[model samples]
Target: MSVSPFRIALIVDGEYISAWQYLMLERLLASPHAVLVVVIFRQSVATTLSQRLNAVLLKVLHALDGRFFSCKPTAQTPTSFLPLLGDVGCYAHGSKRYQTFVSTQRVDVAIELTGQAVLPEMVASTTHGVWRHFYGNPVHWWDDYTNIREYARRQDEIVSGVVRYMAGQAAADCVFYATTSTDKVSINRGVERTLWKMADFIPQRLHELATVGEALFQRNMRERVLARPLSSQDAVAPGLITTCRIALRYPSNFLRKLYKFLFRQEQWILLTTSHGNVTELGLLENFHKWIPPRDRFWADPFVVEQAGEQYIFFEELIYARGIGHLACVRLQPDGSHTEPVKILEKPYHLSYPFVFKHQGQYYLIPETAGNHTVEVYRCEEFPHRWVFEKNLMESVEAYDATLQEYDGRWWMFVSMRSHQSCSPNEALYLFHADDPLSTQWQAHPQNPVVASAAQARPAGRMFTDAEQLYRPSQNCAGVYGRGLNLNRITQLDQECYREEVVSSYLPDGDFDMNGMHTLGIGRGLSVSDAVYIHRRLGRLDHWIGKLSGFIDQLVWKHCYVLMVLPLTFLWLDM
Candidate 1:
């Protein structure tokens, strides 16, 4: 294929990072292309972790640009105005400076990989294409066929306001967008019906995928119904086969609740550390080795126990990338173990894989969090050849779903991030399954049981020590991971569940105060136990941090004084 070595200007938002962005950057720089990046950092220098992370990102970006293809990254200072013009703090003055620089910088294409909404006027002057690194489908508050249309309308209004800001500016020649599943209609429909009417919708090399969406929607319909609780259907309710057929035909809305009723259960006293500080709370004694060094990022871990062996499934994040694998190791009866073995690795990130054995068959359910789908895999030779069977849930902006079987019914609790805001405070959805491993999932009418970000994220599997079920949620009260606040699950079916923080671990003055790995429960040959692991940046990160500090000092002494000192005082007087 005859291709052009495009000159691309990428405006990146530092808030969200995904594998897609990393992969796209690799493609752009690997080819015979030129890229100028204007990175908008959302960090204020006041916070410790934020400053350190931003510094590391700066160093990494600098190294990448110097070593890789023709790439230049210019850090843009955020725009700061007196807090009241009703201006959503999207772009800054330094961003304006970079934009003006790009206008004359011979850049053919400008791609905004940050999921933030940008106006066409921002790149109307560029000759090459303008693409928005859109993630997920444009979700509306209301559930209706016209949802896409409404989303399109809002986008047009927002973009038009931005266009008016750039008077007489010509629109982009072609616009690029990343599509989402189910919302493919809404996204494309809105784009073609609205954005296209404004500018030509250009097709790009990277296409949107729908594998997870299609799989989840198809299989989950059957799985959800089987999971629903059987109530007093009373006089002449729908038959089981007919109800299953209808459920399979018309799946429940992912946002809707499937069941209601709460059951009080025991407490899961999990102990962990954060930011290098080690702290263990609750009945979580003899579980201190699980905490990792600070400077590493870890997520909630899932645990599984089968055949007298305990295993912990966790997300190993190295440098912010998800290491999707079912990390397994023997959890000795004495709460001691060997190093973890890389059990299973999915093509995409594999995390929170809830494993269980049913009638000599080992079934694994992994949360393909970013893929927007969940899948079940059967072990061909027990933890070796795991063939993909079906998806349990799909086409929803959800994460960290944990499945539980209670009162002869299987229920799944998940935190749904609203597509409208991509915020984590949205309600939690509960799904009931006739069979725990089946594809039929029914939604609870009261859907979102819990909607608070502070308690929404699940730490791991909801296990039953005796005959009761308990939910483990991340108690991010102080610093994000200072400690986990344990809660007793009081209800499950009626959706009237409440948690009282019986005990929690607090930071004990260590590097762990800033970061912590997730906590998990596992069982081994000798005894059943819990396992925890986290990633910590090597000492090299600290040295680099020190170096960056030195560089900042030098810049403050030389460049800062030379530029800002003279200009600032003069401008202040003016």
Candidate 2:
């Protein structure tokens, strides 16, 4: 049976509609279950000359480079603009014109995308309760307590300013919804990336809000109203001068990058140990490093002890292909490891070769997200060959597919990102089945069990100690793979899931590395990977490597532009 479409009414600020709001509008129109019935654009009664000039400049820039310069609304808005009095609250109870418009359109749900308090109580009094998009500071108040760098202070202020300018057109409703970030990168490009990344999340979130509004309207209309009212304290207003100072930091950021490139080298993985006790490995001085060959870097190490022999499996990333292949090396009794041999390779990239024993048979589940499927491979020959088995999940963009048996059930944890998302490190999803190899899988009731990147993406294998299970997660707060957080699973089942962070591991010492991300242990042998800047500027190989990398980055960045240039020129000539 098909359900009827829900009518969604949008209350937008006409004089200023942000790119995020415009994207949300487009997403709503594209949704099948929701139809945009009315667009009540609240226009200001008066505007200063400067404001009008800025608006005109924005319109001209959008016409030329709309995709990159998508900061304001365009002439391409789909819905007809219904201009309403901006100061509807000053009127008697509610503006008669606005109330009449709502009543005539029969709006089932009203959404305020322009974080303004221009929404009158009369609108909610007539239609379903109003739901507001509460855009707040990029960095939360709690982030100050973290061990982030000093540069993040100014960057956060700048981001907060941009969010306020774009979203603070009107007063938001009580139930505030916003995205939180703990990233500590201070460069201007980092700030720009964060802002653009958050914009991609608005559409999906708005659709979810509309779905919730529909369910609440059907259940209890009055209960749908937010209990806590929005106040001035809920919003952040960064000063104009401070915002300008932050924007000025962008030119200097290029200098910082150049300095790093000339002084530092590329990041390579370092192998380390923790004796028999993985938790006791606290400081960097305690472990010895295992350096690989010059042409390849090894990372994402997973150790497995079978019978009396121990094997360390990891990703051997070739510099030329820029793709990783599964490699393995035997750990000798003397604490030394043999040279790694490539055991598995595919047309697409692979990493995180999580090996385990199930029913006395060895199996591997490598990170095959590049193939758009999560697959399992059965060991055809010990420590060498693997034959393809059935795919656990297909047609899903997932990464770091970690599997473990817990409480008599096989649970697989993976990170999934939306099609629009650039990083897959923000949403952790779970699937469980009676058998590890079963085709039938059930998604957890609370999908994306963990949403924040700080503790969502799996770093390596999950382990158990003292009757408690702990999962290793990537601490992407400062940057990707900046550190690792060990989270203890307090509660996990089909209905609910919860965890508490037990410990954090950061890279420090003479290695001059930013972070340590992966950790795996088995049978007195603990293996982990650390990232460090590897420089060889004075050497001939360094120049060759540098030239190759430059070409690679250039081609990757402009591949689409190169494809379209010829067609564009041909069309122009015609």
Top of the candidates by lDDT = 2
Tell how far residue 355 is off in model 2, in angstroms: 1.9
What's the lDDT for residue 3 in model 2? 47
Please provide, for model 1 over 1-574, each residue's C-alpha lDDT reduced to its tens digit, 9 standing for 90 to 100.
2234555555554544433244345444544534443333323224366435544543443344334323222112132222211332333425676556646655455555443344454456555345542211222111111112223222211111001112253432111121111221122222222221111111112111011232332232223223221122122211232222222221122211121012111111123322121122223333344543343323445555656665554454444543555555555666655565566676677766666666678877776766778777888864445788888877766666777777788887876643332233224567788787777787653334443333555656665544555566653322233344445666666323344444454433233233232445543111111323221444554454467557545543354344446678899999
Candidate 2 segments exceeding 4 Å error? 1-7, 14-39, 44-109, 118-129, 138-240, 275-282, 508-511, 535-574
* C-alpha TM-score for every candidate: 0.42, 0.70
Candidate 2 residue 368 Cα shift, in angstroms, is 2.1
Each prediction's whole-model lDDT (CA): 0.42, 0.59
Per-residue lDDT over 1-574 for candidate 2, one digit per residue giving the tens place of the 0 to 100 score: 1445666666665544544345555565666756765556665446567545544543443343334334332223334322332322221224586667655656555665543453554254434445543323322321111111213233221221111111232532222221224323233223233333443343443333354443532322222123111123322332232223333333334554675677665555756565644456435566677877667778888988767898999998988898989999888888888888899999899999989889999999999999989999999898999999989889888899898898899999998865432357766888899999987888774455665546778988888888898899987654667678888887777655678777787774245565777887777656777776665454554565467557645644454565567889999999
What 10-residue stretch in candidate 1 is worst by lDDT?
Answer: 156-165
Which candidate number would show the highest TM-score if scored against the true structure?
A: 2
Cand. 2 TM to true fold? 0.70
Candidate 2 differs from the real structure by a C-alpha RMSD in angstroms, to one decimal, of 11.4
Sequence-dependent TM-score of model 1: 0.42
Q: Residue 396 error for model 2, in Å? A: 2.7
